[model samples]
Target: MASILMLTAATRRERNDATSFVFDAINACGGWIEDVHMYSNKMTTVRLALPGTAIEDLIGSLIDGGIAVDPPEAPASSDDRERRVTLQLTFLHDEPDLMRDIPAIPG
Candidate 1:
């Protein structure tokens, strides 16, 4: 099983329950609560590690919850066979498992 990385947050301060609840759910689903790194702007980022989990599956669920994913940009290539795909992700809510803290928020 490959190590799956993910980001989870309530996004709204009013939804503390939502965030806490989601964290609990993740733990129940065999997710490891790694670390939480809050931004200076007050955006709290939590990190969780899950063993034997698929990042795609977690990403799908986040999508279902209105999550947005912003994947890394593809590097430029001169080869004809070389191609790059960019994926951006976001979330309407945190997943049951696989919450990760993003110290440096992606642009």
Candidate 2:
């Protein structure tokens, strides 16, 4: 299977459960959380490595859970089905330059 990449938009810079909510959504979408990176706790992008799960479902759950976001951008095709893929749950608020800490998926 081809790995997927996504970017979710956040509404604010601060919130108590914003991070937790995202995690919960991921779990509900069949993603097993091996590790989590909280970039800013309540402000910044979160990179995830969800395997065998559809990101579209995760986005829907996040929005229904009160975290509205834009559709995930174009995904790069890959043959590395077993590679650990990363997903970016970013709190960009539309600022493109805010993308900085997204971990590179090594080739």
Candidate 3:
């Protein structure tokens, strides 16, 4: 089974570390990124889809690269059937824990 870890960079600010926006390295690590703009915030959203059930190495890599994570966004309706295991996330960017946990329910 494949699992996705998504990290949202809250603002336009960036860091000067080894993990500082290296697109090639991220792609090499089996990750893809989408840039989002919300009002004044230019967020860099990264999605890492890991192969198989093992997620430790990927999580470790994200942590090493200064990327923070949150629990998988919850599904709407009681019938949604995705099993999610939450990794310990770094709260550096401060997740919008209240609103973000709930995935949008399509009408």
Candidate 4:
């Protein structure tokens, strides 16, 4: 059975680069991307379908590549059926100065 894998990642790299990096990792681990959504230049979410057996390898690859991946939750049931796995990756970056150009308020 094919399991659904949902991944959310935040990257500081350019959009194309971040996407490509994820694509490469998934392909290398014998998974295919079903869909991908780019929320912003720094955030991307991907849905993948692959054999349940390959899930560990895919997650390991992402972590080995310097992505901080959260562990997937165990399936609710013991039945051998398709399940949904969710993993989240967060990349830390310095917060931008929102008021850099704003003039100081009068005291």
Candidate 5:
């Protein structure tokens, strides 16, 4: 299913890494990015509609890229049925591996 990722960059130190992760991960995820978004805090939120159910490769890519991921969170309400996962993350741009990924926000 298609979903949105609210990747909170949190601090300046995380921007480059997070940005790199976003770019790489989106590419690895097969160009599913419908929209690319950013905030004053250096946070980037992506709207993606992946073609497959297997997110492991994508997740792994992010992790390997030096991104730290939080456990996936379940949607909070019936109104949120469209969104199944939320990931909290912190990534290191220099590493560039999926294992270094962090998951944040409503996916």
Candidate 6:
């Protein structure tokens, strides 16, 4: 069965290069991209379709390529028919925790 996979990634490299790298990894695993959205020059989100069983292989390939991806999260709904997966990829030293620099307000 085919499933929809959404992946978000942030990189310091040029947007085109990052997109190509992601597309290459997905294509290497036999997956095809359906849609792509760029939130910023450094961030992109891609929607793709692939066999439900091949998700693991795709993640493995990305990790092997030196991209750090967060663990896939289960669908928020409890419905058993949901077949979508979302993953976030972070390029080493590219994404910083800006919130850490924000000071907390007095309670």
Ten-residue stretch with the least lDDT total in model 5 = 75-84
Q: Please report how far candidate 6 places residue 77 from its true position, in Å.
A: 16
Q: Taking the candidates one at a time, how many backbone clashes does each contain?
A: 18, 0, 0, 0, 31, 0
Candidate order by TM-score, highest to lowest?
4, 6, 2, 5, 1, 3
User: If both were scored by lDDT, which would come out higher, candidate 3 or candidate 6?
Assistant: 6
Model 2 lDDT vs. the true structure? 0.56
Q: Candidates' lDDT values, in order?
A: 0.41, 0.56, 0.37, 0.58, 0.48, 0.58
- Residue 84 error, candidate 4, Å: 5.5
Collision pairs in model 3: none
Best by TM-score: 4
- lDDT of candidate 1 vs native? 0.41
Please, what are the lDDT tens digits per residue for candidate 1 over residues 1-107?
A: 22233343333332354345446644554555666544333345556654333334444444444444443232223223312121211233343534568799788
TM-score, cand. 4 vs. native: 0.62
lDDT of 2 by residue, 1-107 (tens): 44446465664543446777777777675565655565553354555555434566666777777676776565533332332335445553444343457888999
TM-score of 3: 0.34
Best by lDDT: 4
lDDT string for model 6 (1-107, tens) is 42444554444554466567778977776667776655444455677765565677777776665566666654222333324554454443455433434688999
Instruction: Report the C-alpha lDDT of model 3 over 2-105, residue by residue, as the tens digit.
Output: 24343333222242242354354445544443442222122333333333233444445554566653433532123223323322222234434333357789
lDDT of each residue in 13-103, candidate 5, tens digit only: 4676567666677666554556655544334556654434435555666666656554333322223223322333433335344343467
Backbone clash tally (model 5): 31
Comparing 3 and 5 on TM-score, the stronger one: 5
Error of 2 at 42 (Å): 5.1
TM-scores of the candidates are: 0.41, 0.55, 0.34, 0.62, 0.50, 0.59
Residue 39 of model 5, lDDT score: 43
Candidate 3: segments with Cα more than 4 A from true spot? 1-25, 32-42, 47-49, 53-55, 71-107
